[model samples]
Structures are given as structure tokens and as C-alpha cells.
Target chain A: MKFSDFICSKAIRHELSAPDKEGVIRELTGALVAAGEIAEEDLESIVGAILKREELGSTGIGRGVAVPHTKHPSVEKLVGTVGVCADGIDFTALDGENVELFFLLVSPPDRPGDHLRALENISRQLRDDMFCKFLKQAKSAEDIQTLLDEADGDQFGP
Target chain B: MNPSEANKTVVVKNPKGLHLRPAGVLAQLAAAYDSEITLTKDGLTVDARSILDLLTLVATQGSELTVAASGSDAQQAVEALSHFIANDESDEEE
Candidate 1:
């Protein structure tokens, strides 16, 4: 699925104030809640679920990117957001490098296919070094949304 | 000395196909060898060492993947990865 399909502009954050992994997740999850995508009562449980997934293994896939995701009962459909942390955070990445890009996904427990597709789309776009470079430099939510649009249009090359 | 190259086509046997978690395991297995490994499906080839690249393949159940490897350990890498893809049963979770 296309990132623009589920990654709402209101959920995009250019500067993640959190300096660590947990805080980063909290900040991003909080963004989704604030945007009315997820209920406030479910916030703690959703963040906890994502954190438990982290315990299985850090979602940090290296190359300054992390896809922290979980299949939750709180959401009836797939919901996600993109956050950039210019200063980077130690996510215990497989590559042992700090992560600057975060793509947090929360999907219903029944839609495994959607979750995988989302991850696939995000990774596919982030694989482009130029896209990652521009995403890292984005200073506003509008800039990040614009980049996603351009990347989805194949402006970055195959 | 030049390294040997090996290629084999294997069917994804996991009920869920080569999804994210299995792809991660496959990538980790490929990374342990010295060979330059890749998987090709539908004319798209991706580095076997990269989980992200592997995920893009979206090799759903029953899909065929051509596993190719070239290096001193080419034969072993291809054989092991092919076998893992074709017969592994530890794909339930994690």
C-alpha cells in the first residue's frame, strides 16, 4: 500500500523531541492520539504493545530507520505516522547505528497483509538514499508529506 | 581465486509466505555466509542480506524465488537458504 494512503499529514512530525527509543515511540504514538486516529484511552496500551514488540527485537532496521509496529485490537484499520528525529536515537539497531527516521504502524490484529504491505512500502521508499537524505532534512510536516508524495510518484527513480 | 556461483529455484512453503519475520530470518541466514546472495522473483532481484529488499519481493505463499549466490561458500549458501525457504517450519511467530 502507498504510504500516503495511511500516513496522515496530521500525524507527521518533523522534530521528535524524545531523545531515546521509548520516548520517541511515546511521542509518535501521542501524535496519532492527538490527531484523533486513536483513542486517548488506548494510548497507554498501544504504546505498551509496541514496546513489547520491541522486546522481541528492536524494530530498528538500521540505516537510520526504524519501523516500530504492532497488531492491536484498539484500531479497526491500519493507522500509522512518520516522525523524524534529527538528533537520532539509539534504537539498538541491527547495524548498531542510531535511527533518525521512524515509521510507527498500528493495525488491527486481523489485517496482517496490510501491516506487511505498509512495512514493505515504507522500506521500499526508504531504501532510496536520496529519499532518506531529504526526509532527514525535512523541517515541517508539510515537507515530509510532500516528500512522501514525490517518492510515491516514482520521482526518486526505481 | 575466483569464487563459485550457484543458483536454485525454491518455492516458498510457509503458509504466510516470505513475510516480514521470515524475511528477517532468511536475511540473517544469508548474512552469515561470505557469498553475494540474491533472490529473484517476477524479474525483481534484491540483495539477500537486506531484509528491506527481501520484503519488497512480497513473495507470498507458493511463489517461486531463484536463490543465487557467488563466493567460496556459494554452494553451501544456496543449498541452505533454498532448503530453509522450501522446508522451514519455524515461521509461526517471532
Candidate 2:
């Protein structure tokens, strides 16, 4: 469940321009669409599904991060993208903090295990404060991907 | 277990298991008490207060988990957490 296993590198956004939660989600999903990881036609439906998930409860797990996700029939497997909103977006999170790091995931409805493992892996890696800091400071998509690559390699101390 | 520590094993009931919503709710509930609590599945244990740690449990439906707490509120904490884990399946989809 390494980040590389599911995250669409080309879809990564180091500086998100969205000003709110829905905007950020749409932004990241659009990136996935642009990267060819998800179908262009599926964008709105996927965004709607992810927003519906948010209505159940905010995916903002706190520590200035949110892992917005949904299971959709549109994706053949798991596909995810990262977006950094350096300014933060209000997510109504459990910790009552705005979110800056967004990890949005869309996966096939049938693959619950992969979804869970991806969540677990993301949580495990994000637990490292240095990783979050570096991710927040990433200045470009390539820089963000490099950090993710290093995270996958266990370069950041846990 | 000491008198100050409480533990109970529970079987997950949510058909979707402990996905983000359920895990998030459980973590929020666990945060309500002063006791240090943990949820264990198989051999892996996580801080009950952390959604991140709870996610790592990846406790799918039918998974058995142990709820353990230590503090003055241990008994009540264990009771509430186990009850939530065993009976709460309201996260089922439309």
C-alpha cells in the first residue's frame, strides 16, 4: 500500500488554488481526470460521491490533513491524488482545524480491502510530523512526488 | 488486568467494517473520556483517540477486536467503546 501504488503522480498539485472543501475536492478529482487515471465523464459523479461521503462526516482527520475518499464503479482500481492548500480549507473536522493536505481517493466499489489498506498506509505515513511538514512545503508536483517517493522509501523517520 | 484497567473483546458488526465514517465516529467517541484507550484487532493495537491509528486497524466486518482502557474512567470507557463497536452499524449506506 505504498503511496506510489495508488497515487497518480501526475495528478499531484503542490499549490492548490481552491478556497474551500468542495473546490479542493473538485480540483484534485479534475487532476486525476487530467492525468488519465479516471475517466473525464466520471469526474462529476466521482466528485458527487466524495462530497456525499463528506456529508456523512468530514474526512478531515485533523493535523491539518484530510483524506477524502469514495468507492465508485467508474475506477478499475484505486486511484488517488494529492493537493496541498497551503492556506487551508474548512472541513468541519473532528479536531476543529482547517485542512491543508488533501489526499483524495476513488476506487472500484468491489475492492474494499485495497481501500482500507490505502487508508491505513496513508495514516501510518502521515503520522510522521516531518512528512506532513515536507508535504506542506512541497513547491511543485515533482517536489511533492519526490517527498511521496521518499515516504514510500521510509526516508522520513517515523 | 489491574483494577484500574478494563478490557473487552468485541466483534465488528458494520457490513462495511470500520471505514472512514465509522472509524472517525469511534475516534470522536473515544476522545470524550479521559482514559487512555486502545482498540486491538488480531495482534495490532492503536490509540483509540486517533483516527489515523484506528484506520490502521483496518478492522473489517466480522473482525474481532479488544477494547482496553486505563484510567479512573476505564470501566465506563471500555463499556461504551465495546458497545459501540459491537452494535453500531448505522453507517450502512442508502
Candidate 3:
């Protein structure tokens, strides 16, 4: 799955200002709501679910990334947004490093396939050092989206 | 010429498959050893030291994967990862 397949382009943010993990989750989830990708009424629940998932274990999978995700009945479809915090947020990741790239995902409880495929795409695409480097360097939302576009176009490795 | 490698096949017991949390745990455990570790699902294999590579397999619950490691500490690395996947419990499966 490509970023276009699930990522809401309108929801992507660059230079995120949220200073903490919980703030970042709420910030990114709010972006989805503002972008009209998810229901405004479901914002609190989605944020709560993602936070709860974080409690189980930080989604900060290391290498300066965090994929905060949860399966929620409130979302009929898989919705995702990206946030780049140049300053980084302490995620208590497995590597115990701060995270700069945040991919917050909320999917319907029933569609495990879409959720898995989205994650597969993210991980596969992130393996490319150039892609990861360029994404972290992106100064604007369009720049990030362009990179995602390039990644989807096969400009990067599998 | 190469050092002996350690390998074992383990069944994924968590109903949710090797999703984020477990994959993260498996990656951390693999990284603890000096050995290089890999997990193979079906015919696809990925570096067990990276949560990213591990997630790519999308190995579902009930799937069988082979954990392979090579280095002086291969056996210990392989055993730890395989056991974790095989015995991952009920609470976290959800």
C-alpha cells in the first residue's frame, strides 16, 4: 500500500509543535478532523484509543519514528495522518530515542488487512535511507507529499 | 568457514498476528544479542533487528516463521525470539 492509499494528504503536517507524546497524538488526530478525513465527533475517542494503545507500549519503533495506531469502531475506514516534529517528542520507544516522524492511524476494528497493509507499506518505504532522510528534511506539507508521491511512483526501493 | 548458525521454526500464537507491539518486542530482543537475526514467514524473510523489516512480513496469527541467527551468540538469540513469538500471551493479542 502506498501513502496515497491510506494517508490523508490534507492531514499531513510539517514542523509539528506538540511538545509531548500525548499532545502529538491529539495534534495529529485533530489534523485528520480538520482535513475532513475523520469525523469531528470521534476525535476524543480516537485520541483516547491511540493513547491507550501507547500505554500498552510505545509505538515508537525506533529510528526516530512513531506509528501510533489503534483499531476503533468509530472510524468506518482506515484513516492516517503524518506529523513531523523537527524538535522530536519523547516516545519512550523501544530504542529509547525521541521520535520526529509520527504516523497516527485509526482504522475500523474489522479491517485488519488494510491496517496491516498500510503498516507494511510504511515500513517497507521507510527502509530506504534516502526516503527517510528526505522525509525528515521536508519543510512543508507539499514537500512531504511529493516525497510520498515519489515513493509511490517507485522512485525508492521495495 | 562461517560460524555455526542457529535456527528454529515457531508458530505465532497471538490472535492479532505479529503486529506492532510484538514485532517491536521481537526486534528489541533480537538486537540484544551480538548475532544477526532474521525471521522468515512463508518464503519471505526480514531482519529481525529492525521493527520496520519485521513488520513487512505481515505474518498473521497461526502463521509459522523460522527464526535464524548467526554469530557467536546465535543460539541464544534464536531461542529468545522464537520463544517470545510462540508463547506471546492473551492480554496483548487484542
Chain A TM-score by candidate, in order:
0.98, 0.97, 0.97
Tens digit per residue, CA lDDT, model 3, A31-62: 99999988899889888888888999889887
State the lDDT of candidate 2 residue by residue for A75-131, as single tens digits.
889999999988888998878999989999998876878888899889989889999
Q: Model 2: what is its DockQ?
A: 0.58
Looking at model 3 chain B, report the run of 10 residues with the lowest lDDT sum.
Answer: B85-94
Interface DockQ per candidate: 0.49, 0.58, 0.60
In model 2, how large is the Cα lDDT of residue B2? 47
Fraction of reference contacts reproduced per prediction?
A: 0.30, 0.57, 0.59
1 against 3, candidate with superior DockQ: 3
Instruction: Output the number of the lDDT-best candidate.
Output: 2
Of 1 and 2, the candidate ahead on lDDT is 2
Poorest 10 consecutive residues by lDDT, candidate 3 chain A: A108-117
Considering summed lDDT, which 10 consecutive residues are worst modelled in model 1 chain A? A110-119
lDDT of 1: 0.88
State in Å the error of residue A30, model 3: 0.5
Query: What Cα-based lDDT does every candidate model obtain?
Result: 0.88, 0.88, 0.87
Query: What clash count does candidate 1 reach?
Result: 0
**lDDT over C-alpha atoms for residue B35 of model 2:** 89
